[model samples]
Target: MQTIWLTEAEWFAILRIGLGLWWLESWRHKDKKDWFAGGGIRWASGIADKHRWPFVRRGFDLVVKPRPRLMAYIVAYAELALGLGLVVGFLTPIALTASLVLSLIYLVLMIHDWAEQGQNLMMALISAVGLFGASWRSWALDDTFGLFLQ
Candidate 1:
């Protein structure tokens, strides 16, 4: 067989695996304790507090307001679900959609927090990666069914 460069879908699948691993590692790091005890939820709430924009902060506050502990649980679970799904390639469309939504929400909050916020750029990039990373082709279960976007 002749050498062949990776297809777009293949590249996306590779990206999916890497990103999924990154999220999984993050979830594992948070699994050591309850979210309220300086874990994932607390981390998410703390970041939310930094948002200075009224509507944005308000939105985050509504999700985890006055309850960092609860927020912790939600964040941890969400991360776990999204991370695991992406890593395992069980549900590429759903996993990628969830990742994109979460990242987009974070982007909005960050930009609202600071008129000159720089975090938004990073979030935007991550969202784009989820959208185009072609992650449904590689290590995912979607690949087994021949359901890649190709």
Candidate 2:
């Protein structure tokens, strides 16, 4: 924690902010109209339906299929919300944890898909680093407002 132009906390903050940007990019690149119209869910449904994992199939059917529209909105907006919260250092802990969980869910659902797994694993790892390092303590709204300061 001693040999850099930026301090340790600042480095952590950069990581946190970068992850936020990644989430934002994920949200931004989506076809919002198609997603809102159920295309995204439909695509996921197709994958889930043919998934080799029984649990994934069951979980998707149980949690998402019944409420496709709601789930679609939730997934789409959740990324946007996570990005905004993390980028601004507001509710960083909650945002990191939620993003970690979301990343895990994606990893599980996309098991055997190496490309997807790599991205999800990296996202989850970054979330863990930010959470454990208390990255919000620097360059964050949480720091300014004295939230989650220890």
Whole-model alpha-carbon lDDT for candidate 2: 0.92
The TM-score measured for candidate 2 stands at 0.96
Cα lDDT of model 1 by residue, 73-128, tens digit: 66667778877887788777777777777667766655545653454454345546
Residue 60 shift from truth in candidate 2, angstroms: 0.7
Error of 1 at 87 (Å): 1.7
Model 2 spans with C-alpha error above 4 angstroms: none
- Model 1 C-alpha lDDT versus the unseen true structure: 0.66
Per-residue lDDT tens digits of candidate 2, residues 4-79? Answer: 7888888999999999999999999999999998999999899899999898999999999999899999999999
lDDT values of the candidates? 0.66, 0.92
TM-score of 1: 0.71
Top lDDT hit:
2
List TM-score per model, in order.
0.71, 0.96
